[model samples]
Target: MAGIEFEIMEHIGKISEGKSGWKKELNLVSWNGNDPKFDIRDWSPDYTKMGKGLTLSAEDLKSLKNVLNEMDI
Candidate 1:
């Protein structure tokens, strides 16, 4: 596979941290210089590496927010 390119447009927040100095975070990212999107994934301490994660568009993010708001807990 070809190398993936990405830019962290915004650092939203950290969800959790692991013992390996990797942290699960939510951020806005642009893949291959395309438009930015909401991303949730794990990144190494220096951000030189990342794990598989989910990417969502603005519409999807709004839907997710609605779902979360409706959840009892």
Candidate 2:
């Protein structure tokens, strides 16, 4: 059997931090050696673990940007 593979290509920024020091971050990640994508998730302090996350492609990111731009927040 083979194990899943992933690489954190870049550390973008931290969105928030939890009490235990885990951080919710946005990063560029490549899974299974595929192209990198925008990823948002919670990561352990040492980055040895991660929580569920959303991965977005360039087109998806563009759409998200558009929607966010139109938001009042």
Candidate 3:
């Protein structure tokens, strides 16, 4: 299976109740070192239908770290 990694850029807001709120905008990036072929603008993940928030498996997180380490970027 092809490995995938996700990165999130969030804009956080501070609430009057002394709580922090974040809106996560995600980017699914690949380490292939080439331009992405698909359109990211059309990409969407319906967390409500999936019954979960954004998350990754342990193995996937490890792989992503490895890729980043190897690239040293």
Q: Report the number of the highest-TM-score candidate.
A: 1
Mind giving the per-residue lDDT tens digits that candidate 3 earns over 1-73?
1354433233122122212222233333332454322112222233111112333444665677699899955
* lDDT of every predicted structure (CA atoms): 0.95, 0.92, 0.34
Between prediction 1 and prediction 3, the one with superior TM-score is 1
Enumerate residue pairs that collide in model 1: none
Model 2 stretches with alpha carbons more than 4 Å out: none
Off by over 4 Å in 1: none
Ranking by lDDT: 1, 2, 3
Candidate 2 lDDT tens digits, 1-73: 1386789999999999999999999999998999999999999999888888999998998999899999998
Model 2 scores a C-alpha lDDT of 0.92
Residue pairs clashing in model 2 are: none
TM-score of each: 0.93, 0.90, 0.28
Predicted structure 1: lDDT: 0.95
Worst 10 residues of 1 by lDDT: 1-10
Question: Could you arrange the candidates by TM-score from highest to lowest?
Answer: 1, 2, 3
